[model samples]
Target: MVKKLHKEGSLEPQIEDMINRINELQQAKKKSSEEMVEAQALWESLHRELDSLNGEKVHLEEVLSKKQEALGILQLHCQRKEGGAQRKNVLQECTEQISVHNCQVTESCRQRKLGVQVEEQLENLMSQHKDLWELHMLKQRLTWEIRALQSSKEQLLTEEKLARDKLLEVERRLRSPPEVGGARMVNDGRRRWRYSRGRRLPQTVAPQRTRPAKERPAPSAPAPAARTWSRPQTHRTRPAPSPTPLLRRRPEIKARISDRPPPPASVCSPIPNCFTNRS
Candidate 1:
């Protein structure tokens, strides 16, 4: 818009409009540069956030692996419990058979041998029953523990999945805005270059601008050299302070375009916390 304006116009309205357009373009450039700076700061913050999330992910994975190892150990215990229960059932069947045959022995010597055999078998059965009872109690406890770990593992898996989703979402947010800022800066840069190039003042304007410097000659320690000094220096320092402070402010506006290095501890505006504050 600023480029299309005729700065060499013959009328006052045209000149006024051109100046207005130039100011508007510069203001827009300033705004875009500020946005670019903010976006860059945000980009770095998001990267740091990404690193934090990655570390969290790794930590969670380690915890999950540990849980899995625990689950595996419980599974092994459960298997052993099952095997012991099966062995207990076989021993119980053998005891039942022995009891069923006890009545068949009737004679004196035979009865004595059967009686001794039955006493030994009863002792063995009592010991076996005690062991079976303990095993049953242990099995019950193990089952309860296994169920708890299974439930916990499932919960951990769910949390991991959610974290993964949140990471992706955050990364997506990180990628999008820089493209917009870059395009905005490119277009604004081009407009600023064209406008400045077209409106560059001629060498003749330098002496007029420098004439004010000559008036303030007390600061020019070598007052005699100041006359000869104005020629080379005036052209070089195109941004010589003008009569109006408004003209001085224009350079400040340009300075505002310079990128601000983001502080490491800079606490920015709160990003929407989808990861932690999810409804």
Candidate 2:
């Protein structure tokens, strides 16, 4: 897309192309994330298999050592049976060793059966441990969810309290008579003030005087304000007008395939009318 945008050399096509590229990038990121998750799962399975294989290897090595120990005990028994005799016949020695082995075979078979039972018990315990681990993980997840829910409930309660307070304030305002802008006593208790349309104005502390209803006082005409609002100004002098600045809009150029090379780019600034003529 970048290459295509550079080749096109136009803003209009680049807009849509760049947006499409952004969407593609977002989708690609999601796809990569999913692939990463799958890879992680695969890695976990491989690690578990490796662990199981290692356990089996250890168990087999233990069984091999036990068998080697049994063979040593059998050899010792055969030597005791010989009892310092100079026996020349190999066949006679083999016959006697076989008869001795037959006598101990029953005990070896019983021990082998015990080993098998222990292996079965170990398997059962491992299964129970797996179940317990799953339950523990479930408990932790539920605990976390409960905490989150509790936090949300507390937040909701706080918001409800704030809303109730606002409601009470509004009800109080509605129940009371509306106040019109007039003279209000200050916290200082010395000077009186008034707020006309939210702007504070100084009030004089003079004695009240009554005038006849038919008598109208003659006063000078009020002065006009510079702006639409009658806001108090710092100075009475009016601001003089200045000439408005003029800016020329850049002409639009249509994309066309030309054999000639495109012109070099010009510097563009964000400040308004920086390139405009000052005259």
**Top-scoring candidate (TM-score):** 1
Worst 10 residues of 1 by lDDT: 189-198
| TM-score computed on alpha carbons, candidate 1 | 0.33
- Candidate 1, residues 1-279, lDDT tens digits: the string is 334444444566777887899899999999999999999999999999999999999999999999999999999999999989988998898887776666453455587888899999999999788677656655654454456446544644565465556545645643343222112111111111111111323322111122343444454344343122232334455454222222333344334322333222222222232212211
* Alpha-carbon local distance difference test for all models: 0.53, 0.53
Residue pairs with backbone overlap in model 2? none
True-vs-predicted CA distance for residue 185, candidate 2, Å? 99
